[model samples]
Target: MNSDAAISCPPDVLDGSRALRLACETLDIEADALRAMSQRLDGAFSAVVQRILQLSGRVVVMGMGKSGHVGRKVAATLASTGTPAFFVHPAEASHGDLGMVTAGDLVLALSNSGETDELTGVLPAIKRQGIPLVAMTGGLQSTLAKHADWVLDTRVEREACPLNLAPTASTTAQLAMGDALAVALLDARGFGAEDFARSHPGGALGRRLLTHVRDVMRSGKDLPRVQPEASCVDLMREMSAKGLGCSAIVDAAGTLQGIFTDGDLRRCVEAGVDLRARSAADVMHPRPRTIAADMLAVAAARLMEEYGITSVLVVDAQQHLQGVVHIRDLMRAKVI
Candidate 1:
């Protein structure tokens, strides 16, 4: 038969309702497996966490087939969260990659059946090297578990697969177990968002945490500012030249006294005040929102958001005008 004919299903068999029912059943099975696993947690789970915490080197994760795929994800999560880890394929380890497992490192091997030959083949070498082994598997008495120093039971009653041959719920349980381990380790090490951001410097969280106001604020000649006694024409000229939509009113010592924005200009116009005759202080909004140069750029975004303002001045300890951070500046830096 052609490929299409071989895989084709009857109309009733392939109905949308049946497909949705199957999807719901798969999710329910997996969710139940996770709940059962959560209830089964005991001292063994705590011991595994303590073992990983006490390790001096990285976690070397290994497995075969589908388990290996899960191992790779587990290793990546652990590495990014604070615990250093990497995946080494079990088959490759038997060849020559076993050298990657160093003295102080810990080995986390995953195998649902706990009897993968390629995985079991290297257990003796790992044991002889005096490295600690933690096995995540269903077989309590299997060779893999027997050789392991710590065992994390990941046994599921059945796979989510209809035929019960493919790994579905089992892999979900293993992945959840791996996540639990990483979260526990993260808490124990006091790994906060800033610490997490350091590992992911290119991510959005990193941009928010690592980027400072000084890095994105317009300073020097680019900053729009005028003396409090300067004419309104001078303030308008500075605002237009700098294109920040606002100008700072500073005193002789460059101390920020107030800010005059286009909104203030419109309000003055509505009140029939002549801009040509006014000084900077006559129309400026005193004590405008200000942020420190060392503050996070995200904090500047927050202040702008909270006050419903488009621009804010960066000030020193004495409230001296250092720079101006417009909403556009935050956009250009991708900090907002």
Candidate 2:
């Protein structure tokens, strides 16, 4: 069996309060570091954003070690949010990847100490290429900062690590600063949800934005439907054949009259009403919840959840029965 397949209880379940306290303390340290760093944002932050926005090419993010990991995430955030960016390992840049950077591109380097050898090693090439450089570092006087066109200070009061040697608070501060810059640029570019959805076509958000109700609905013969004058037996056959647990009852003009669900059948059975004797209109729910076929599938999902329903009728502009949409269909399409 896969190790991740098994769900394990916390080994220290009895130490819940102790664990909670420690976790909260760690979060507090990182949060406080971000707060202090936010207060320190000034002209340099503005200058950095201005430089990035003016660039027609990608933002080449470079870092070493822990800062490198944070740089990758920052680059991804920038790319997905409209400011094109990608991360290059400082070591790799010193080799051959340095060619990836163009003069039109802007370089954003991250080094908490601002003296990381791997990063400083590639400074000359970046400068020789005349690529505008922006630095994120705690040390303003360090070489990486001195050689850059702009710098964003990410200084933290202390590390959350007990030894103060690990980069807990400092890394958190750097990540927060990166996020701040990305968000600022996002606002500047006027990047909307549709633009983001296009960039992330395979994710859940993409599905929500791109999928429409008509695309996933069962139409024509596949739709579970019955005439308002049809008997309960006919409704049951229609519902069972379609496997939707419900049937839409429409009038002679093909306009929706009501819906008869499994729950309605159960109620009728308890009341001792014979299924063969009654018409679908006599036992159906009038004015049933419905959605337009052109509406977003995710919006239909929200309507179902709000009404505590498992399915809804899809109708045209004039409330004519067009199709049937089930929660299962939305789930299978990954829109739910």
Scored by lDDT, the top model is: 1
* Model 1 per-residue lDDT tens digits across residues 236-331: 999899998999999999999999999998999999999899899999999799999999999999999999999989999999999999999899
Per-residue lDDT for 42-155 in model 2, tens only? 998998898889998999999999999999999999999999999999999888999899879999999999999999999998998899999999999999999999989998
lDDT of 2: 0.91
List candidate 1 segments past 4 Å from native. Answer: 1-13
Candidate 2 RMSD computed on C-alpha atoms after optimal superposition onto the true structure:
6.7
Indicate the TM-score of model 1.
Answer: 0.97
Error of 1 at 296 (Å): 1.0
Cα-based lDDT at residue 307, candidate 2: 88
Q: How displaced is residue 229 in candidate 1, in Å?
A: 1.7
Q: Where in model 2 is the C-alpha error above 4 Å?
A: 1-29, 161-163, 192-197, 270-277
Summing lDDT over every window of 10 consecutive residues in candidate 1, give the lowest-scoring window: 6-15
Which candidate has the highest TM-score of all?
Answer: 1
